[model samples]
Target: MSNIESLLPHLGEDDRANFMKAVGSIGAAFAARTTIEADPQVIAALPQVRDHVLSGGGVELDMSAALDALKEEPSISNQLIAAEVKVAEVSKIQSDTANMSRIEKMNYARERGLDRPRDDVASTMTMNEHAAVLAGLSPVQRMNYARRHGLV
Candidate 1:
């Protein structure tokens, strides 16, 4: 028998069942809160723990220790933080681009070398013309434009 299974003999049948159910519930709750990928061993163990609890035969397991064990496992928390940072960066870029005037956007794009000629007439281009040039650039190009102009 496993070390955990050997502990079951200390509890009465009803208490064992309840303990197993509690462990399963705790595992489910932990899975919901974090992005940790599921493991087959963990999947199988939760139900067994519940079964052992239901069997009403095991010693009282330390609930805090069980929870701590889950907490100690490496999770996707870092990946989540990185993803959030990327989203915030994209959001900031979009906000900066939206705030720029058409002329400023065009000049910013030109500074990024987006193939538009740096003609003397560029400074005199109409708002519509500026918008047209800005529209021709990709979203990434627009972000670069904003970054070059210190708008980001």
Candidate 2:
């Protein structure tokens, strides 16, 4: 299957694109020059970045060049710096998109009458109704409810 084909089921177009971009960035970084011993932190972050890039099809870069860039930062190693920058950006993008996708999936489930509460045999509410119920609660209350229900 194509990279986005499988991911498409899990993400919307925008999110999928961002995710792919993040993944591509990592791939480029991986392909770029790198020195394993230059910075341990950078070394550690490289794999994570690369994983995102390869999965997302974002960019193709010379891994050796990336490594060299990291090595340039002698203080903490450019690897770590690059890794941090890449990961932070990608992670934020991933999380936001994932949350949106989750909302969509949840809404879809509700639309299909698939999110019926186990305890309420007659409470087959629509997505809107479920959303209403959630909207009525405060953020703290929601957190408490989720915690109580083991959803957190």
Q: Give the winner by lDDT.
A: 1
Residue range 37-128, candidate 1, lDDT tens digits: 43434532443454446455364545455554555545434545665786897676567679799898777667766435345324655557
Lowest lDDT block of 10, candidate 2: 35-44
Report the C-alpha lDDT of model 2 over 8-123, residue by residue, as the tens digit: 45766665565555445544454453423443334434443344444454454345555555555565465567677877976765664575677786675567545543453445
How many angstroms is residue 89 displaced in model 1 relative to the true structure, after the best TM-score fit? 7.8
Query: Which regions of candidate 2 fall more than 4 Å away from where they truly are?
Result: 1-5, 34-152
Error of 1 at 12 (Å): 7.8
TM-score of each: 0.31, 0.21
